[model samples]
Target: MATEERNHVSNGEGDREEQEDEKMEQFFALLRSFREARDKRKHELRLRDHEEDINKKMKKSKASKLGNDERSSWVPRFEWEDFTSEFEFPRPLVVFPTPYNKKEDQKNQEDDDGLDLNLTLSSASL
Candidate 1:
């Protein structure tokens, strides 16, 4: 009888140890899963912050470029007299000669003769 009681107690203790080990394993698994979830959330938040920062910088850069373009497009008004007064005569002027046409040449000669006749008549009246 004593040996049977001892065997029964040993069996109960073994069963209790197995149950405790299973509970400890479940707790450790739950803790690991929680930590992983927390880490994932932190990583996502950091990524979101970085994207927001980039978007802000892009907006600022675009705004600055637009402002520069607007500034460059502005033209200051000046008076016609001011422009004429600032002109320097006898400066090298680049002229592009068009292809000569006979009809145009004849018309120009006639215009010059008419001007000469007008000048003679004006001088006689003077």
Candidate 2:
């Protein structure tokens, strides 16, 4: 009877050891899965950050290019003359926005023609 009891005790200990080993394996598997998920999320965030930075740089680069183009498209020039030999109540000298732009010159030409007709009619009446 004593020997049988010892055998049963040894078998129970072996079963406990196997249960502990299975528990440890399950814990390790769960930890590994968590680590993989964390790594994947970190990688995705990094990619998103890189993409956002690239987009921002592209926008700034394009905006700067557009600004440069617009600035180069037109440059203004001004002329000044001393106020001498002037006898008109309203100034008769015409001022233009810029002499280098032909489109503006044509637009102003129509206005000037109409204004000249009105001025001639007015001065003739006076």
Leading candidate by lDDT: 1
In model 1, the Cα lDDT at residue 11 comes to 97
Tens-digit lDDT track for model 1 on 1-126?
999999999999999999999999999999999999999999999999999999999999998988786666758888888867767768788899999999999998976665554435565366
Residue-wise C-alpha lDDT for candidate 2, range 14-93, written one tens digit per residue: 99999999999999999999999999999999999999999999999998988776666656665454345555667567
Clashes, model 1: 0
TM-score of decoy 1: 0.51
User: What C-alpha lDDT do the candidate models reach, one value each?
Assistant: 0.89, 0.84
48: Cα error in model 1, Å: 0.5
What TM-score would every model get versus the actual structure?
Answer: 0.51, 0.51
The alpha-carbon RMSD values of the candidates against the true structure, listed in the order shown, are 18.5, 17.9
The local lDDT score (0 to 100) that residue 117 gets in candidate 1 is 40
